[model samples]
Target: MFEEDYKRRFVFGSDYGTSDYKYGPITLGERPAVIENRGYLPERSMVSKILGVEKDIVVGKDVAYFLESGADLSSRMIYPMRDGVVAKSDPTAWRVIKELTKFSLEEFKPSGFGFKGYYIVASLSAIAPRYMYENLINIYDEISRETGLIHASTIIPQPLAVAIAHKELSCVVVESGHGNTQVAPISRAPIRDAIVALNRGGSEANAITAEVLKDSGYGDLAKEESLVRRVKENLGLLPLNLDEAINYAKRNPEHVRAIYQVPGTRIKIDLAEYSWTRFLIGEYVFDPNHEIFQSYFKRGMPRPSDTRVGDITFYGMLDMAETIIRAVERCPVELQPHLYSHIILSGGNFMWRPVSTMKGIAVDSQTKLQHMLRDKGLENVNVRLSPEPQYAVWRGCIVYGYAIPANYRWEWEKMEGWVYHTK
Candidate 1:
C-alpha cells in the first residue's frame, strides 16, 4: 500500500519530442509543462560575462533570452532528435538531452519526507534504436545516483504511449511531429514489424509556406522560418481537394483571403492575390507527389527525400492514406479492419481547424483523413484526432509509471518494467 501510494504521489512523465519537451509529475493534471526541445551553448564573450551567465549550456525558457542575444544561433543551438531519432556520435545532442532531463527533474524535485525518487516514464520515437534506449537509461541512472530524484525509470515508444493514453489497445496511431510522421499499429503492445514512417511532416508544410510567402511578395519574410511557420499556422488551409479549393479561391478570392499580424510586432503578412496557394501547404504535407507540386520543385523547393536511418527507411513521398494502408496491412490480415476502423491521429501536425464558410472545400485533419481513406477504398473507416494530442504521450507515461509494480524488474528482452535506481 505504501509503495503504490508513494508512486501515485511521485510518478513523473517526460515526452522527448522533436520540437518540444512535455514533462511533469502525475499531479500536473491535464497538460504537462512544455519547453522547446533545444539547447544553446553560449560562446564565451564579454556579453556573456555581463549577463552573469556562467553555465556552458542553457535549457528551458531562459534559452530564448540567450538565443535573442546572439546572431550565431544556427551554430550554437542544437536540436537533439532528427526525424525522431538521435545519432550516437553527436555529443552536443546528448549534452542537450542530458541537460534538459536534469533540469526538468530538478525543477520538480520533491523535498518532502518519505519521497525517495520519481518513477519516470519517458517516451521516445518508435524507430529509436537499442543504443538510444541504453543511452537514455544510463542518463537516468547517473542522475539518480547523483541527485536521488529517480526511484526507477523506463522508456516506451511514442506510438504506444499515444495508444495507451487514448485507451486504444487495438488501433493504429499516426503520430506526426515537426520533422517526420510515424504510423504504428497497436494490439495491447506495439506491433514492431508493422510500423511505417514518413519523412514528411509539419516542416514540409512550413517549407511550402515559405515558398508561398516568397511568391506573395513577402520574399524577405520567407528567409525567417519561425515567421513563415507563424504565417502558415494562421493562414494555412487544409483543402478537401487541392484543385477544387484552388478553383474556388480563384473565383471567390475574398472567401479565402488571409492576413496574419505577427504577435507583439509591427509586421503583418497578407497573402492577398496568392490566397489560392494556401491549399498547397496542407496538400503538400499530406501528399507531396501530386503533379502540381512539380512546378514548385522546378522553382527550387526541395523535395522530401527518402532517407535511410539505421534499418528503417522513411518514405518521403507516400501519401497519408497509402502510409496508413501500408502500416495496417503489415499487421495480421484479420486485424486489418480493427486497426483501420479505429485510426487515431496523434500529434501537433494534426492540429487543424475547418472554416465553416468553405464547407466542402476545406476541412479539418480528421475529415481530410477520412476522405483520403475512402478514396483508397477503405470502407467503414473512422478517423479521430487524439484528445489533447500535444500531451497524450506524457499523460500515458504518467499512467504507465503509476501502474507498473516496483518488484517487476526491468528486462531487456521484454523492454518493459522498471530499472530500479535504488533498492
Candidate 2:
C-alpha cells in the first residue's frame, strides 16, 4: 500500500540540464512551457521569452533570484529536475533542485497539490521503483499543500517523452548529453524494449580531447576545453585525405591549425592547430586506429554479446559517426528489424558539416554521420534532427504534459508492490 500523504495527482515532465531547466506544466487541459535558469539567475529577457507575460509581471532577475532577494518568501518550493533522471540521488543536487523549484513557483503560477490534476513526465530511469515514485509524489504534495493546493502526480518515460517531442514514430534516438550518451530504440509511437546507456558523452568527449592536447606538446592549448569545443564545433570534420593528413601531421609538427585568444590572462593569444608531425591530438573520432582504443586489447576484447567500445581513432569525422553506427549494431537485432524508418540524431555534437579549409581539412561531423548510417545497411533510415537537440528531452516532457487524459489519476495505495505501466 502507498501513503496518501505522499501522492500527487498530476504528472509533470521535466528535462533538467547543466545550464538550464526545461519542463512543462501538465494537467488535464492545456500544457504550457516552463524554462528556468538553474545555472544562474535568469535575466528578465530570458524569463519574458518563456513565461510569455508582460515585462511588468517579471521585472528583473529570474524568479528564484527575486524570491531569494526577499520579494515574497512564503511561496512553497518545487523540486529541481536534473539532466539525467538519477542526478537527484546526489546530496548536493537535491539542494539545488529545492532552490530551483522555489524560483519556478515564485515567478509563475503558485504551485499546489489540491488541484484536481497532476502528472509527471520523468526519465524512464526515474520511475524504476514504487518507493521512488511515492517519495517524489510526497515531495510534490508537501510543496503543493504548503502553497495551498492539492497534490496529484504520475510519470512518463523520458525516452518516450523525447520521442513524442520529436514527433517521430520510428527512429533511433542518439542523445549525446552532458553526462551520458544514451541510445534507445523506438517505433510506432512507442519506445522499444531495448535501450543502452554509456558512461561517455559530450563531457567525456571534451575531457578526452583536452587530455590529448595536453599530453601532445600542446599543453597550453589543452586547458581550454571549452574553446577546443568551440573550435571543434566550428572546424572539426572528417578529412577527405585521411591517410595524407595522418602522414602530414607526422611530418610537419609545426603547422598551426587555428589560433584562439584566451581572455583576461597574460597568456598571449595562442595559435592552436594540429600538425601531421605532432601526433594527432583529439583526432580519434576520425582514426579507428588511434592509440586510445588500443587499451581495449590489454583489457581483452569484449564478447560479442557484451557492448564495449573498441579503439576508433579520430582519423576523420567517420570516427564519431562510427560510434553511433557501432552502438546501433550492438543492439539486439531482433528488437529492431530492417523496417525502422528513421535515425533521429540529437545533441550538440551533430550540429555541423565538414568543409574544406585554406590551411588544411575540416571534417563535417554530420556528413560522416549520414554516410556511416547509410553504409551500415540501414538505408531505409532517414536522418531526423531534433530541433534544439539539447532540449529535446525537456520538450518531450512538455509534449507529454499535454497528452495526459483528463480522467487520469495516480492512486498509490491501489498499486501495492506492483510495477505499473501506462501510456
Candidate 3:
C-alpha cells in the first residue's frame, strides 16, 4: 500500500512560456495540456456577489468564456510573461501565474489515502532575475498553504530544460518562443556567462506579417494580432537568400501567390501582388538587419531595441549566425567546437515547414541555420529541431523531477532542489 501510494504521488512538469503554459503530471505519458499563459480577472458581477465568487481571476481555457462575455478584455486580461519576464511590482501578472499554477495542480489533484502534494519542476526564461525566482517560490508556497497542492517545487531555465529533454549535455540550445529567443551553451550544465538573448522572436514575425497585410490592402485586419499570427504561420516562407528570393518571387508571382483563411472566421487573406513579401517575414526573423525591414521601421514599427533585463543583454538586430557565433565564442575555445557542432533549435519560433509547392525555394529552420553557418566558414555543424519543440521543456522538467533525490532541499545559491513550504 505504501509503495502504491508513493507511485501515485503527483509529479508534474510545467513549461511557463511567454505565450502558453504547457503542463501535465508525468504519468500522462508524452504530451501535456497547453493553455494560453494569459489570465482574466472578471469584474464583480451581481451573480458573483450572490454566489460568493471571491476569486475573480480565471486562467487557462476558462478565460475564453470571460473574453466572449465582452467584459473589457483589454483592461481585465493579463499576460504574465509578456516579455519573458514579469516585474516584481506587477501583481496582476503574478496573480495570473499563481492562478495558472493552482488550476494545473487542482486539475490532476488525486483523490485517495496518503496523498501528499505534487513534486513539480517549473521552467522559466533563461534571463529571469533572481527576484523572479524568489517571487515564484513565494507564490508556490502560498498555493501550498491555501490548498496543500505542492509537496516540493524547483525551477530550471527553459533552454537547460531543452538540453535535458534531448539528452544533449554539450550543445547550444536556442529556445525561441513568442516574446524572445535565448541561445544557451550547455556542457553538462548551462554556461551562464555564454548565454545570448535576442529581443526578436515570433511576435516580431507577426509584426512584419501585419505590415505585409497592410501593404496587401488588408489594413483593417492588420491590427488583429491573432489573425496576423495565423496568416504568418500559414503563409510565411524562409528563403535561402532574401534578395534573390524576392527577385525570384517578383519574376514568378503566380507561383508564390497564396491565400490563408482564418480558422473559425469568414475572413480570407490573399497575398496577391505582395506574395513575394512572404519570404521577408521569415528572413526578418533570421536576419533582422536586412535593409528590407528598414521600411517597416521608418513607418513606425517599434524596432527591436537592445535592452538589458536582469543580468542578460538582449540584442535587437543580431542575425542568427552572429548570435550563435557570439554565444559560442564566449565559451572556452576547446569546448566551442562541440557546442557549435550540436546546435539544438527548440521552440515555437523555429517550427517551420517546407512549402511543398515551393520546394526548391523554401527552406526549413534547420536548413536555414546550417546554410548561415556554412557561409561563415563553419563546417560539420549539425543543427536540428527538438523532437517536440513545444513540449521539450515540459518533458525535461519531468525527467528532472524524477531524477532529483527526494531528500534534496532547495538552495538559493545553486537554485536547485525542492523548496520546503511552511505555513
Q: Which predicted model would earn the best TM-score?
A: 1
lDDT of 3 by residue, 183-265 (tens): 99999889999999999899999999999999999998887666788889999999978888888899989989998888787
Per-residue alpha-carbon lDDT of candidate 1 for residues 145-192, written as tens digits (9 for 90 to 100): 989999889999999999989988999999998889999999999999
Q: What does the lDDT read for residue 358 in candidate 2?
A: 21
lDDT-based ranking: 1, 3, 2
Report the lDDT of model 1 for residue 253: 99
Steric clashes per prediction: 0, 53, 0
Using lDDT as the measure, the top candidate is 1
Residue 79 of model 1 has an lDDT of: 84
lDDT of 3: 0.87
Which run of 10 residues does model 3 get worst, by summed lDDT?
A: 1-10
Higher-TM-score candidate among 2 and 3? 3
lDDT for each residue of candidate 2 in 177-256, tens digit (9 for 90 to 100): 54444566666543333455544444444544454454345566555434556544433444434555666645543443
Native-vs-model 1 lDDT?
0.89
- Ranked by lDDT, the better of candidates 1 and 3 is 1
